[model samples]
Each structure stands twice: as C-alpha cells, then as structure tokens.
Target: MLKGLIFDLDGVLTDSAKFHLAAWNNLAQELGIKLTSAQLDSLRGISRMDSLNLILKYGKQENKYTKTQKEEFAAEKNEKFLEQVETMTPADILPGITELLADAKKAGLKMCIASASKNAPKILSKLGIASQFDQIVNPALLERGKPDPEIYQRAQQLLQLHNDEVISFEDAAAGVAAIKAAHQFAVGIGDKQILKGADYIVKSTKELKLDKIVAVFKRNNKKVG
Candidate 1:
C-alpha cells in the first residue's frame, strides 16, 4: 500500500504554468531578449531564481545582468505571476484533485507537496486546501532545487515514509527526474510522449485512479498491495 502522495504544485495543482510562461516571456521582452516555447518549457519545475538564470543563459544575456539585476527581474516576474493567480478561486482547482485528496485521506495515505516553488503554500491556500497536506516542502526550505533530489528526499523524511512508500506526481520532465533520482515511484501527469522517464504517465490529474497508482507500486514491490 502506498503510504503517501507527493505532488508538484504549479502544473500539477494549478494552471499556473501558462502564467509562468507569460511572465517569463514578458520579462524576457523587457530585457530585449526572445523566449521560445521550448525554452520556456524547460523552466518548468525549477525555482524562480534558477529559471531566471536559465533564461539569461539561453538568451545569451547573462552578461547583461548582475546578480542584483537578476534578482530584480525574477522578482518582477513573480509579481506578475502572483497578480495573475490572484484572480484564481477554489473553482480553479484541478479536476479530480479535490476528490483525490478526499479519497487519499480516507484511505489513510499521508499527503504532502514537494515543489520547487517558494509559492507552494500560498497557492494551496488560495485553492482552499492549505490544510489538506500533512507536510509541504517548498524551495524556501531547501538549499538546492529540483533535479537534485533534495526536496523530495526531505519531504519523504519529514513524512516519515520511505521512497517506496510514497508516490510522487509530476508534470514536468525535471520533476519526474527528481522523483526517480530520489528512488520514489513517479506518476507523470501529462502526455507520455513528452516525459520519458516516468514510472507511469497520465493525460491529466483527473485521469488518475488510485487503484492504478497502487498497482504500479505493487508491480515495483510486492509489499505495496
């Protein structure tokens, strides 16, 4: 049996990725740089500071900004992102997420969020489900970001669960990589074609069936059932 569910925030819980892309694009334009969708996609599941650095490097504009300038640009991007998400209500909760949370809770599974975003708690609060999680691992608490496995490892440790006892839900390639690197089962919530290393891939969070998730764990370890 799976003892816990770890989730990524931006693309998994909220439709904030589009807003992030917009913010990055807008900020890039302000810096006299151009951003491609592919470049924007690579920023998913990364911290804002790391994302800003990636954008600067990709656009060949790293020399254009000092550390202070980078911070200012990143801060401006987040301000825009928060402004856009301010309009989101509980109505914007992802399909099946509320039900999934209720079901998981009833089934005795510990639930937590492990996100690179420093904004994870605020986003969950805005969605009216701040108290749903047993624990939350945000960027603020970690010295390193996703793809490093630190965040997920910390969340598992905080929840008192082993890697096999928890299953992570992710929407981006980097997130999937992090979960796997942490030695946890990962469910990729997006097109499988786009995410190659996930243990299981689903079209959306709404399509996630607990039984199926458990089955994957069962396949990995006979004790999971």
Candidate 2:
C-alpha cells in the first residue's frame, strides 16, 4: 500500500539545480577553478560542503582551504543561489506537478520532501506550494546525504508509514539509490539509463499519473510478495 510520496526537490520539482550550479560556478571562478557541465551534474543530490570539496578536489586545491574558508565559500554560494530562487513563483512549478499534487491530496496521500538541500523550505515557499507537503525532511537533521538511506528513512519515519508503504520520486541516480536503500519504491523522473536503479522511470513529471503509478506499484509489490 502506497500511503505516502517522498520527493526530491531540485530536478524532480523544478530546475533549481541550474541556479545551484550557477552559484557554485561563481564560487569556483573566484577560486580560479572552472567547473565543467559533467562536474556540475555530479553535484546533484549532494550536500553543499561535499559539492565544494569535490570542486576543490577537481582543481587540486582540496587541502588548500581551511575549514573556515570552506564554510565561507559554501555560505557565499548559498547567497547567490537564494537570489535566483527568490524569483521563483507558482508558474515555475514543473509540468504536471500541480495536477499530481492536487490529485495526491484528493486521494489522501501524504507527501513530503526528502532533499539534500537545506534551502528546501525556502524553495517550496517561493514556488507557493509549501502547504502541499505534510513534511520536508531537513537535510541539516540528517547525518548523511543521498545514496545513504538516512534521509529517506527519516522521511518515511516522519510520515509514520512502513518503508514499503511509501514511494520516493527523484531525478538523480543518487537520490534513487537512497530511496532503494531505504527499501521503498523509487520512481525516477529522467532518462532510463541514468536512473536504472529506480523501480520505474518516467521521462518527466508530465508522465506521472497517480492511477498508473499506483497500478505499477501494486504489480511490483505483488511480484516481490
């Protein structure tokens, strides 16, 4: 029984990952490093500091910055990211998401966000859909980031549902791995090859339909049973 849905905010909801990459690029430029698109893509579903470390390692400067300097860089990147997010509005909601959210609410399904971003709340508010979610798992409260089941497990716990009773939707491979590690069904909203670990894959939110998803989940569960 799928009683709840846990979603990853960035790619699954909106294209805020672009803003995040832009901000990270700004910081990298100041540090005399250039970030490639591949490197930026790899940062999806990753924590701020971890992303910074990866960027620094790419520039062969990981050990060059002290803890304080790293913290300051992360803070500066966040300020720029926030500036971009501030311009978001309900119109920015991804295709088919508004309908999906409304349909889920009508079906009495609990919804929550399980994102690596600490700014999840602010992003939600900017999109004007903060009230749609029953909870937003605070990344700060977790000990580990994506690909480690911690955040998704925490989200399931918050929803007061068994692991198998929840479905997690994500766009990143890391986020899909986290959902699978938590023993929940994962619906990947991206290329099939990139999110092969997911139980199901949809090209975009526009392909998400509650009835079809519920049917697929039931069939998958039956096979497992």
Candidate 3:
C-alpha cells in the first residue's frame, strides 16, 4: 500500500517551469545564444549551473565564458524568474492540485516535495501552499540534483517511509529517473512519449485522482516488499 506522495514542484504542483524557461531564454539572449524548447526541456530537474553548462555546451561556446560570468548570468536569469513568481498566489496553483492535495491528506498519506528547484520553499509559499507538505527536500541541501536519486531519497527519509511505500510524481525525465533510482513508484505527469519511463503516466494533474492512482499502483505490483 502507498503511504506517501512525493511531488515535483515546478511542473507537477505549479507552472513555474514557464517562468524558469522564460528566464533562461532571457539569459540566452544576453549570452547571444539561442535556447530551443528542446534544450530548455532537457534542463529540467537540473541545477542552475548544470543548466548554464548545458546551454553553453549546446552552443559549443563553453570556452567563451568565465566561471564568474556564468554565475552572474545565472543570477540575472533568477532575477527575472523571481519577479514573475513574486506575483503568484493560490490562484496560481494548477487546476485540480488543491483538490488532489486535500484528497491525499484525507487518505492519511504523508505528502512531501522532492524538487530539484532551489526555490521550492519560495515558490510553494508564493502559491500559499507551503504548509501543504510534510517535508521539503531543498535542492540546496542535496549534493547532486535529479537523475541522481539523492533528492527523492532524502524526501523519503524525512517522511519516514521506505522507498516502495512512497510514490513520486514528475513531469521531467530526470525527475522520473531519480524516483525510479530510489526504488519508488514513479508517476509521470505529462506527455507519455517524454515521460515513458514512469511506472504510470497521467496526461495532466487534473486527471490524476487519488483512488485511481493507488489502484493503478497496486495493479502493477504483486507486493510492495
């Protein structure tokens, strides 16, 4: 039986990924490099420095930037992201998320956030839903980011649940890989093709009902142990 629900923040609970993308795009403009949607998508569930590196690598211009310049550029992008997120409120919570959270809580499941975002706390607070989580695994605290399982492992540890007892929701491939690496059930929350590694894939959070989620998980596993 599932005892915990771990969610990814940017794409799962909110639409802050758009803000991040926009900020990165602004950064790309400043750097005289163009970031395609695919490139931006690849940056999901990674650190700011990793993202900047990916951008640099993609443009084959890593040799052109100094470490300090990279840091400054990341900061410039963050400023724009902060501006967009600062105006967010509860209304910014994605459709069906409020209800899903309430239903999960009522079912006695421990809820936590296992996001790669360093701004998880700030974003959750801006959405007026910071209190919704039992524990939040801050990316700043993790030595490695998603696709590295450490973040989800920390979240499971804090929730006091075994890996198999927790189910994680993610929209990014790296996020799914992390959850899977942690030995937890992974639920994908977007395009099936991109999110194919997930144990289960739901087109949107709106379509993910609590009962159905558990039912699906149970169906896939003969036993949780």
In terms of lDDT, the best-performing candidate is: 2
Q: Which candidate is the best by TM-score?
A: 2
lDDT for model 2, please: 0.92
The TM-scores, one per candidate, come to 0.96, 0.98, 0.96
What are the per-residue Cα lDDT tens digits for candidate 3 across 83-135? 99899898888888999999988989999988877788999998988888999
User: What TM-score should be assigned to candidate 3?
Assistant: 0.96
**By the lDDT metric, which is better: model 1 or model 2?**
2
Model 2, position 164, has a per-residue lDDT of 76
User: What is the Å distance of residue 193 in model 2 from its true position?
Assistant: 1.2
* Clash pairs detected, candidate 2: none
Question: Relative to the true structure, how large is the alpha-carbon lDDT of every model?
Answer: 0.87, 0.92, 0.88
TM-score of candidate 2 relative to the true fold: 0.98
lDDT of 2 by residue, 1-225 (tens): 889999999988888988998899889999999888888788888889889999999899999989999999999999999999999998888999999999999999999999999999999999999999999998988888889999999999999999879889999989999999999999999889989999989999999998899898999999988
True-vs-predicted CA distance for residue 175, candidate 1, Å:
0.2
